[model samples]
Target: MAFTFDGPLLLVGAGKMGGALLEGLIAQGLDAGRVRVQDPAPPADIAALLARHGIAAEASVADLTGPPGVIVVAVKPQVMDAVFPPVARLAGARTLVVSIAAGRTLKSFEAHLPAGAAVVRAMPNTPAAIGQGMTVCVPNAHATPAQRQLCEALMSAVGEVAWVEDEASMDAVTAVSGSGPAYVFLLTEALEKAALAAGLDAALARRLARSTVSGAGALLAESALDAAVLRHNVTSPGGTTAAALAVLMADGRFERLLKEAVLAGEGRSRELAK
Candidate 1:
């Protein structure tokens, strides 16, 4: 379902992810005039976009006059304590609060808002900046069906959206999709280094590594086959691909290393939530 706010939409931050969401909302045909943004010092580019779109921008939530229909919290987790109290004043019975801050729980938001306020906790990766994000949202009991649908639709403006029944699983979600982009980027860096080691020019190595990773990602997105199936398709028995796989797959080294990395990330997320 398409999402449009019934009243003014207040954006608590206009940093990278928040700015990206604003761009997506405008691209999806939401009226910029109905949006209000509060950021102490927005980046020059973001300020320009807000001016061009005629979105109301303020230095603080205290400058906002009326209650907003939707309150999107995009500030860093560290600053949420300072940001929540002032914004909570804007939460009426119908206000739907959607937070994209990692490691912050719905209960934490509810504690700061009015009793029974609808809250949705979401985790979106850095890819969201380019409209290719994968977001997972979980709503509290106070969130109605319509509110949940609205959250999904709003999130889909950036990319894929999934709903989770168990909030505890969010740490795993954080480990995977939330931190997943960095893993891909690291892989790209490693591939470039490997290419350089193989005598390729630095510029050529970077270009090839980037293109290969991006092209492979696009192929995975467009294809219905499983990733394992795609990998098998690329491998011919006793060939160069198989030779490389022998090392990567030997003693399940790669798999074990990845699992360890994910566990470490999950642990960190849990610590931050506390």
Candidate 2:
């Protein structure tokens, strides 16, 4: 993908998400001199990663310099107030401020920056840790189309990118993909336990459970067929798969349970934003 933003990029944190972005950018051929990281006590592995990639990681925000073209805030929600001010001072007036802090709104950044700063709020999933993440970017009214494009380019280097006009939809995004990995992990665990209970050896159960889920995901990703159609393709009439489906779909229990779980996550996202 052709990208226009070429100046310095600053990241405020070096946690999982921040580290992932740095790695992705390096993979995308971003120059080491163009990226600067600000994180105290950076993880040793990530520190080595940045060092190996030739990107600079500073111990203090004061140590970072230059007129940033893209400044990403990847810190936790709880530390936003503490991190934003110094970053605001360092960012250029025309810099595009991108954030992946869950539940942190554009307005929150606006409060700490000069009026009319270009802010883009994003919610990215953990799969970003491995460059298969899905991210949603919502730009504030102050942001221009060019800035939005820059945001898309930066995020797409890691994985997929989508734009949302309504900020309220972020909570829903968080509820779905942001917390989606845990659901899949739980399913994997449950399948392994059930396989073990059904007289399978531990190693066999784990292999079956992991491979089945991963292969299904790979198939879905490579196909144009809808998930419902794919699922139906696997279920034969009066078969064992059908029997399992009957229990899972019975009385709409699974659907309702999933809905409740997403709602609970959405509520917590709102609470954290406060």
- Best candidate (score: TM-score): 1
* Model 2 lowest lDDT segment of ten: 58-67
Residue pairs whose backbone atoms clash in candidate 1: none
- What residue runs in model 1 are displaced by over 4 Å at the alpha carbon? 63-65
Candidate 2 local lDDT, residue 141: 97
So what's the TM-score on candidate 1?
Answer: 0.97
The pairs that clash in candidate 2 are none
In candidate 2, stretches whose alpha carbon ends up further than 4 angstroms from where it belongs are: 63-65
* lDDT (10s digit) by residue, model 2, range 1-274: 5556756788899988989988887788777777788888678888899889776677665755466788899988888888778888877778889999988888888888877789999989998988899998899999999999888888987899999998988988999989998999999999999999999999999999999998998899899999999999999999999999999999999999999999999988887774
Total clashes in model 1, counting residue pairs 3 or more apart in sequence or in different chains: 0
Candidate 2, overall lDDT?
A: 0.87
**What are the per-residue Cα lDDT tens digits for candidate 1 across 17-101?**
9999889888987878788898888888889989899875687767556678999999888999988888988888899999998
